[model samples]
Target: MDLYARFDLPPPPPPTVFSRDHTDGRARMPNFASVDEVSKFVDASRLWRHSRGANDFLRFGTAYLLVISLLVAAGILHKIYKRSFWVFRIVPRGHSNILIPNVHNSWALFITPYLWILAASSIAHIIGDARNEPVVNISLWISIMWSPTLFAVWYQAWGLIAARLGDGSASFEELPGHSLTKSMPSWLINAVFLLLPVVPSVAASLVGAIGNAHLEHARYGWYDWHTKYDGTPELTRDMVLDAQNIFHESIRGAYHVCISQAIWGMMCFLFGTAHSFATSSLIFSIGDHLQAKRRAVLAQKPRIIPQALPTHAPVIDRSLPQISQSDFSFKWRTADEAISKPLPSITCDSMSTDNQHSRIETRMYTFGQRMHDQHISFFPAIKSSSTIVRIEASKAERVLNFFIIQSVSIMLGTVALISDSLYMALHSYAAAEANNYESAFITGYIAVVIITLLAGTGSFISSTHTTFEASFTALLYARRFDPGSSDISSSGGERTDFLNME
Candidate 1:
């Protein structure tokens, strides 16, 4: 108590003076009236804080959803178009030639869907501001939407390279009809398909990184609009507060959008990769089967050759005449004059022997039929029976194997898509419950990725199957007909002779 009383000095205070000689160049300090003045001054200069608004987040979410839905619709339409029964047509050329009519170009099939998705998404983005809830964050939505198209582009480019490297055509129509084994170029096609899905995922990661950088800048004071003060007039406190709220809301919306976009991008990449892998595997299996067919054909080495033979008949003489030596000489001279110097030395036995030997040689060397003893014989029946069995077995195996593999690939792709959708649904539910809108937006993006990946996988599988079928048909046709031979001759000669011979 005594110390407090001495230090407090309530009633009066004394001032001390210093001599200039003793004080070494010291300056006097200013005194504050009270601690309250310092506190009030500090409080006056400090920035005000406000709650983040929800309007901008709502706008972004609305836009994102609207755009994505349109994209989904477009994708569905594309699927319908591809699966339509009217897409294929058979065009007949004369009595012998048949062609499958192709309505749209290959590039059209690949590009049109992407274009539709892009257009629809763009429109949705433009109209988003008016909707109650925006589709998604605009920036994120755009990034996710662009992935499939970008993947397609990459796929196409890689496909071209692979085709060139394999010395094959780049068209989807060029794929093997049966198995990868049968089509020498099928592996290359599968490889290209497999490679395509990676591009979109990588692009997504890059975009995410960029978005994060922007987010960081925003987090700091770098882009803070509230900090800018012009000489014309300072913003009122309310205006400043409002601006800050708007900025925060915008940031939140953007962050949610980016998160959603990134998740979508990742899903797409994964789906695409999985699909490509599955399709490629199927293609390889088909190729292998086809190769087996080729090998079987090669091993058989069946040959066909025309048979030339002469008909034989017994000779019979009913009448004979006897002549004297003088008569004989007169008859010979008369015969020589009548038959234009007479036929030179008629040797029936010699001619007969030569013909028999030639026929024997032909029969011995030929692979198919042999006609001997005035009867069609053993070799023809054996050859024909073997050929029929081989053709039937080959065709059945190829078609069955290809169809099974393709079906499996399709099923797998579909299941993957479904799984992705389910996961998204769960994530969405969690986000909603937690009031974590950003997580919910990302969850919704899974649908886009799944759809795109499924589309690509389905297309590849279908195309591969088509290719196998075409190849098998081509092979069958080649085996059945001679490439060097004509079905119809140019000359107006009767086809009866050809028909009879066949």
Candidate 2:
């Protein structure tokens, strides 16, 4: 039942995987030995700081925001007209820009909305942190989380974009043991996410948005909403009290701005993490599909996999195959040796032709240098390495990586559910004894419920992602399009042989 047994490699490495510091280039800081070493380290540190100044960091940070917004705006335009699209070649790498593959709900397309949510939530965070308003001090901190969070996502995104559009193809997977993206976690950004629950009630922030968040239990909060009512209408009298009571008793005014925005930010972040993780998982994502095709090429044998709506090609009325639950369970049922050996990496490229017969192409690719066993992993560990078939994400791998990710989501969901239950139980007593508090309780409650849904949905999708992918992968490995087979469907001109990548 051990997933690692099926592979040619060992089990997933532990979270605290320790190996030699394989950082190349002697340009790094010197270890403390003598005063000279300390001086040398200090000098190197300053150089790094000077090279990547604050302004540069801010520019990169803001640039990413603008790029996401522009993508969303352009998608709206393309979706409406379908043909009135103009590809803005920021750094056009010959004809590759024109051949951008049309994947089924590419992350590049949907990612915009998630970023928008983060931006919206960030506004509330920034508002809460504005010292000029009430002098609420910064009391929160988030560990930049380079391996799996901000740094991982950023460099991978950059690499994928750079490789896909710039070079040719890009492949990636999560490796908690591997190193890279270790610039320093920006204290400025980290501190901004941490804001005082109220003036003078600020508590010091811990790692990763864990601070004294202004959740609904503040002693006092300023209410910011007002509506002129022609004397409290008789019918609306009790309802008004209940709504106000809901803010104080249910969520407290703190939940309205601070807590909800933070939750929104958390949920969006997980969504982004899921996108990056999907590259290695066998989910129903475009990247996964492309990966499936790549695996088929490396398949010592042919395979038959479930297919989704095609990309860029004409809409097909015919469904090629469907991955049943039994098929998915087969992978997790036990690591089947029949399962195809995944490549170290696969680079997928999308090319649109000028003629009507345009189709996504998978050109042959070869990895440069393969990391051998016993060698320490270091910066840019994403190089030609692979994880367990994420579609068939083994128990070994998810036991740590996926479990941790899902646990965070589950924990948030459980807490929110519990909070609501307690609020309901205490609402009447608190409302009866209430005097005055002007917090957006109803609005906050709505946001709270939405946040719960976000967490729940995110967890469900990730949990099922491996299942769906594993099942689809199982079906493909067992049966593929062969002209000799009776049950196999037509290939629809899709290539079966791919050399590493395109």
Candidate 3:
């Protein structure tokens, strides 16, 4: 139910050829020697249950301060609770990859950086509150933490990208997913994949946060960090003026040029943004495409019909010598034996004692005849199979990514423009009423950002959602499923277990 769990899955793997994903991994796909062997993995009905989906109780409870109450309860009940009081899980959906090592560890260990960032951010916020400078503290923290956080997010949830690399089954199908051109080498794609995150990570580290710090120090309380380190950058006068000038230009005179332009670097998202793509939405789209895919998989699932040998079992105790004495015989023949004569099976009715070919031999001849009649042949045709490619991120992919960057740039610029317009409106009203300007620009732009963030998050998620063990012991528990109640429903028939996953 929490907003963050989807992004909390494991990091995406380095780019690999399509083949290595299924066949080359250390884990072995189940091998079936017979129908019975394959049946071992099949379920009587789908084993997936709705409650088995991703549940980030840590994030959910912490979001509402419910964790505080949970902590108190856990302190009291620590003796009786031998099992975990809570669980957070992300089930592999459709054919999405998970547990590649084929083992689940403590979720805390599995996603270490997630907790690291959480602690870092919480401490930053606490420091901000302590300093009575929430704005400055947050601005600096976001800047310093931006790069690591980006890595952490991917480290946690990148595997979702793997799902888009191929169709759920072996063969590649691109209608609902992304596949870079075959000409693109996997090394190139790996390079691109590696470089994409670095773009924003470096950008955020360079300007987004540092710019805020420079602007705060220059225009507000001037501090020279040369004599002693104050933990802030040792920005030169030129750097301060430059950061201030560029930032003010971004503000678009909404702050009355000289004084009002400082709202804690509110427009600081200029050069740095996450390396997400419109492709990601298309990749993570939770619309009809995912539902359609699920339906297709279920519809295509192989139906197993139990087959049995004849109820009247065959008695086959006939000795080879006894059979040899009769018209029928079992003998190891060398090439010399067949050099001058047709084999018994090929000699008309002599292949069988009943003056006919055996059942298998007859079936083969009949199949050949049917094939000839139908003009059907498979020897010359290729069946569906997997292809391995190390792909480079395409020019098309780069173009799309750049496209999103421009779009975000325009969106932020538009937000600035609209904020300025509202400020003008407020300025006019204040002049007419002979009252205060009421800080309309700051309040107005922030409201716009909140509304935009809400809308974007909603649309984005109509798209994505990943797991582990150093197990997080839940301080409290919430049960949404009850076996005593026969209110069970299948996420099958329509969708799949992936959908049933929380």
Candidate 4:
């Protein structure tokens, strides 16, 4: 009322307005009708930008590192590091290995480079960051994902091979299943499993040691301290203090690197253990299915029992066949049995009493039971394929292995965190004076947090997926080869539910 009275001016347009790009370029206004709408708009814009930034950064860094490593490995390093380091070579067109196949070679193509990048990058970044240098870039940091990726590739390549071996043929359908190292003895399997974690753990430790050495060299100059501080205790106190500080920082930095290595190595070992279990399951399933198929084939075959002696044959009477059986209770006889009989049938008087008939039935049942037991004893494979399915499909082993890996990783992370916290707390005054050690500790703490979270998710998802796929494959094979078992279908349903729980 005041504005209208003051000057006959039109009300100003709402803030939520935009011009439409059209033939007329007309202005359009939306009703910001409710607070929800405004909030939604703001949220959408903010989230989109945030997601885009993170995605772009990761994408750019990964590609940059991958390309650079590939160029160096394939173009430059290939000539120098022939067998010692460069073990992979790209197959020329139409020249791929028949046994290994191109898919594997292609996978190794990417994975080998990634491994190289990871091994190099971890050392470089840890050393640089420890020394408080700006040498390590964002791209190198992002490439820390190399170890997990390596685990995945290693699992896949070996898993596929194991599975195919279980299937006993190179059919496309059987190309990607798992199997136990069946040909190997039990001792070999145990030995390999036990030794799986050692190599990577050792390598990580060595790398950490080298990085620590580098840190110490960088931290402490190569001059005689006694000469620099002049031998007097009072004059040398500050120098001695700095030396102690440098040594302490070097140890801390090295410890951080070692923890990271141990974490990744443990992860690799976890996958290795999972691979062994899955392979064993697959082999068990394959064995069951094959045995079932063999039994079914054998069962269908016509068995010819030796012709019994004349006295052993069932008595038959062709004469007075009109009666079909005389007082013989008129039991029907097959045409072949009637014709083969050596003697005529007995009369009604020869028919056995009811008690005798019961005794005979009991004898027949006992004989059949004895034969059944003997069959199972002779062919242990006669057990239902459903049991095999159940054993192979259980996710318990995979889950247990995963929890072990997770527990170990968490413990390492906690130790690293505690050590860093203690170091910072005890040297708070000196750290503040220098201002570098505190930052290093904080950085290490942050790294531990990020790595712990990533490792947890990566290990769980990858290991679960591998276990599920291998088990599912075994189930399919079991069902296909052992169609008589209704239990297989039910077990398959249970497996689906169990995987959903994971």
Q: Rate the local accuracy (lDDT) of all candidates.
A: 0.34, 0.29, 0.27, 0.34
Alpha-carbon RMSD, each predicted model: 26.7, 27.2, 27.7, 24.7
TM of each candidate vs. truth: 0.28, 0.24, 0.30, 0.26
* Model 1 ranges off by over 4 Å: 1-114, 123-232, 303-502
lDDT per residue for candidate 4 within 1-502, as digits (tens), equals 2322233333322211111122221111123343343233322211112223433443444454455445434633443333212222111112221111111222334444544554454454444444543223222232254343444344444434433432322333342322444344545543563345456545654555555454444234313332355344341234433333333434344344544444454554455455445444544554454344334434332331223236755654433211111121112111011112123333331122221111100010111222232212211112212121223112433433443453344345434434543443344223222323334333443444344344434433433353443233333222222334332134332111100000
User: Of the pair 3 and 4, which is ahead by lDDT?
Assistant: 4
Give the C-alpha miss distance for residue 294 in model 2, angstroms: 12
Clashing pairs in 4: 162-179, 163-177, 163-178, 179-279, 180-279, 316-344, 316-345, 317-345, 327-348
What 10-residue stretch in candidate 2 is worst by lDDT? 350-359
Clashes found in each candidate (C-alpha, N, C closer than 3 A): 31, 18, 14, 9
Local distance difference test, candidate 1 = 0.34
Say which prediction, candidate 3 or candidate 4, comes out ahead on TM-score. Answer: 3
C-alpha lDDT of residue 370 in model 4: 27
